[model samples]
Target: MALDPQAKALLDMVYRVGAPRFHELDVAQARHSFEKLQFALRPEMPAVASVTDVPIPQARAADGVIMARLYRPLSAGPDEILPLTFYFHGGGWCIGNITSHDVLCRELANHSKAAVLSVDYRLAPEHPFPAAVDDALRAVQWSLANAGMLGIDPTRFALAGDSAGGTLSAVTALAQRNAQGPRAALQLLIYPSTDILSQRPSRREFANGYMLDTGSLTWFFEKYLPEEDDWQDWRASPIRAARFDGLPPALIITAGCDPLSDDCKAYGEVLREAGVPVEMLEFEGMVHGFITLGKFFSQANEAVLQAGEALGRAFAAGGAS
Candidate 1:
């Protein structure tokens, strides 16, 4: 499909105004550049609860002191036990937080008719790769061990995130499978970074113009990894792992114009080949971070709805588990 008018408008604005020459800029300047790009997409969005009618509160992961923003869909108030989604916001695992991704989580919670726990994990460069992964694992562990306290059903929860956060979600699943961590019902990955290699054709082809460019990605990788070898570690680059068997069911979302699009495709293939029930959907002509742009971009809205529906089917219907 051709680029929708709204998505095209977004690309035009990004190239025309938001694209910063961060090559020589300081770290703070580059961070500002990234934030400006996001703001340019939509200067502001309604509060998460307004968008999805969810009650939002802050929770803490006991071990790492990781903060988690819990979203209970208005459709399911206190006293109503609902399926849960533990989400990590996407920002190459180095940036973004609960507020940056609040709207997305609420939509997922409301649209999927399930509670959403949007975790605010520690960022990279300051905290780095394994830190985020560790926080994610511990958050899941705490959620399971204390599900009753949080009013969640331990057996009815799932893991989800976009981009690098998606990497954490995927790795968290593998961790559970490998170390026998708390079992999640399913995993939802939105254009996830299953591979840290980032050398696929999509990365090269969309390197310069896409929302998440090669240069920016390089910055993120540099900031997130503790060492070069971490790039190949399964915890960082899950697609590099030898096996993905025995993991939970997965729904992988990919964007045709995203630098990491092929990562999602490859990961979906890996999951399927490993006998994990997997569903893959690629949004053609769409750029990276479509989930965040849905308010102004029609394809993005459609994609989120499709994703929410998929989550609903996977969790509520209780299939493919």
Candidate 2:
């Protein structure tokens, strides 16, 4: 499929002469660039019942505490306990913070009628590999353990994220399954980097022209994984996990033109083969990162609606079970 005109226009603007790509800039500059794009393209923030910043105390003292923002839908009653979706924002695990995804979390809460907890996991380079993964797992566990206090239904918890955040979600879900911890009702992965070691066709096919280019990916990986052998770790690459049979059902969203598309599809196939239910949605003619750019792409809004519906159905089933 041809590139969506809006995506093409974004690419044209991003790649205009003298514009510095992410790989060309320092980490701070790259993050600023990424945030600028998100801020300019994200839709206006919708009203929600409440938004609270919660600090999650890490199990390991040295890891300190991570922050998460919880959003309660406008329709939620003061005393009602809602299903919870622990959301991790994307930025290759290096750039984005809770504020970057505030609006998206609000939309998810309203549309899914679930409380959305947007986690601010420690970023890369300084924190490095396993840091974000550890933070993600800890946040979920903490949230589940204290669900009553947060006004969330512990039995109906879900995990959700996009891109690197999606990777964290997948890894965290796998870890929870392995540990026999509280199982998530669903896993919402949008353009997730399932395999860092992937050499799939889509990696090369959409490598350069897409918004998330090969250079930027390499940059992210390098910053996050300073150890070469960590690339094979299941936490870093969920597709490398030993098994997937007992994992939660997944809604895997992919962009047709994304370099990570094939890897995402492969992960879905792996889940299906293991007898785990999987729903895969591919946004054709779209590039990576379009889901958060609802201001520029109509499909972004459509995708969010689909994701919210999936979360609602999964939470409903969980509650019944």
Candidate 3:
């Protein structure tokens, strides 16, 4: 499909209004910029189920401090727990926070009508590698364990994220599968960083000039991974996993113009070959993080709604539905 005029205008505006996102900024500054963009969007989103930040007192990771903002619809009131999504924000695992993804979460919660739990996991290089995987796993387990208190229907829950956040989402599902932890009904991965190793042609083809340039990716990866060796670990690279079988059903969203596009496509294809039910979409002319640019890009909002529609179809009637 041709580039939507709105998409082009917003893309140009995003490039001009601010600087390309970088990993050099501290969490506070990065989050500030992210939140600024979110507020700028003030998008016309559907009236959601509901939204609130519920502290999980029992969810302290191996280190400490594990809290997630829980989102749901009004129908799924405090008394009714609904299928949940343990959502992680993206920023190469160093920048984004719940506040930054607040609108996206709202859109998802309103559209998916599930208990969307946006996690605030520990970032790096302060806490690297397994720390992120551990935090994500802990968040999922904590949500399931406290499903009652969190008003989430344990039987109907999913896991989702975008970009680096998408990487963590994939890892969380794998950890649950291998350890026989609570099952996630579905996995929603949006332009996820499936593999840290830049081995694909798209990596170079779409690398430099795109919104998420190869240069920025390298900088982000360096800050997140203490050593290059960490990329080999399956925790850092889901594509390196020995098997993707028996994992939850998946919804993989990719950008036709993204450097990591092939990696995301490869994951969906591999998962399907492994006997998992999967759905994939690559929006042409879109770049990395198109899922979160609703403020500036119409395609961003459209992608979210499209993903939400799929989630509704995948999760309608409940987890088994």
Candidate 4:
């Protein structure tokens, strides 16, 4: 199948400008470029009832605090304790932050009718390896413990993210699957990198012209996990986890043209085999990050609607429990 016309046009324009690929720049420059591109490509921001910034303090002052931006849906009642999605934005664990993903978070909140808390976890190269993982786990824990303060329904909490952030969301579900730990109602993964080291067919099939090139993937991995051994760590690659038996149900979304398409499919299948209910959707003709480019892609809204409906179902089930 051919690439979506909009996707192809965006790629053509990007190449025509000769914009430096992410792999061509140093970490700082790459981060700046990524944010600029995000701002330029994303649609006009949707309205949410309210958005507030809150910081989750770390035990060590040196580690710094993680910031989260909260989005309350326009339709949510003032006194209602809404279901919540604790989201992490994707930038290969190196770039992206609350500001870079602001619009997407608003859309998710609006469509899901759930409060969204987008975590600004520490990036790599500076934080590296377990730092992002640690911060992500901490954010989920903090959200669970402080649900009342945040005016969210603890019982209907879920984890959701894209790309590296999606990886983090999956890893968090595995990390907190204890009897005493907070149980996530759902795990919504968007084109997640499950097996960081696995060279699935899609990695090569769509490696070059797709929005997320192999070179950029390599660059991100090199910056975030300099040690080759880090790729095998289950924390870094959730697919390597000892078990997925008790993890929450999942809705894994992939783009057929994404380098991670097969990886996501594999993850979902393994989870299903382990008796965890899983639903995987591959949007043929779409590219990685299609869900964020609503201005150019109608499929973006379709994906969001699907995700929102899934989230709603999970929340309702959680409430029933």
Residue range 146-263, candidate 3, lDDT tens digits: 7778777777878889999899999988888898776677888999998888588889887765777777788778878878788798899898899988898988988887889989
Which one wins on lDDT?
A: 2
List, in order, the clash count of every candidate structure: 0, 0, 6, 0
Candidate 2 all-Cα RMSD: 1.2
RMSD (Cα, Å) for all candidates, in order, is: 3.6, 1.2, 2.6, 1.5
Q: How well does candidate 1 score on lDDT at residue 299? A: 73
* True lDDT of residue 81, candidate 1: 68
Cα TM-score of candidate 1: 0.89
| lDDT at residue 190 of model 2 (Cα atoms) | 97
lDDT of 1 by residue, 1-321 (tens): 355566677778767965564444556676666565556553244333322222222254344366777787767765776678889888877667777776677778777887788887778677876888888887787777777767777778888998887888999998888886556778889988877786788878888766677778877888888699888899988998878888888888888788888888988988899899898888788888877765577776677778777777767766323
Of 1 and 2, the candidate ahead on TM-score is: 2
Model 1 stretches with alpha carbons more than 4 Å out: 1-5, 21-25, 33-64, 319-321
In the range 1-321, model 2's lDDT, one tens digit per residue, is 579888899888877855787788998998898888889999999999999999888887886789999999999999999999999999998898998888888999999999999999999888899999989998998998898889998889899999999999999999898888888889999999999989999999998988888998999999999999999999999999999988899999999999999999999999999999999999999999999999999999999999998999999886512
Which digits, one per residue and each the tens of the lDDT, describe model 4 over residues 1-321?
579788899889888989888899998998898888788778899999999998998867886799999999988988889999989999999998999989989988888899999999999899899889999888888877888899998778889999999999999999888435767889999999898888889888998988789899999998899888888999888999988887889999999789899899999989999999998888888998888877788898889888877887888876412
Give the top-scoring candidate (TM-score): 2
Model 3: how far is 251 from its true place, Å?
0.7
lDDT of every predicted structure (CA atoms): 0.76, 0.92, 0.78, 0.88
Candidate 3 error regions (>4 Å)? 1-7, 14-29, 42-49, 57-62, 317-321
lDDT of 1: 0.76
| Of 3 and 4, the candidate ranking higher by lDDT | 4
How does each model score on TM-score? 0.89, 0.98, 0.90, 0.96
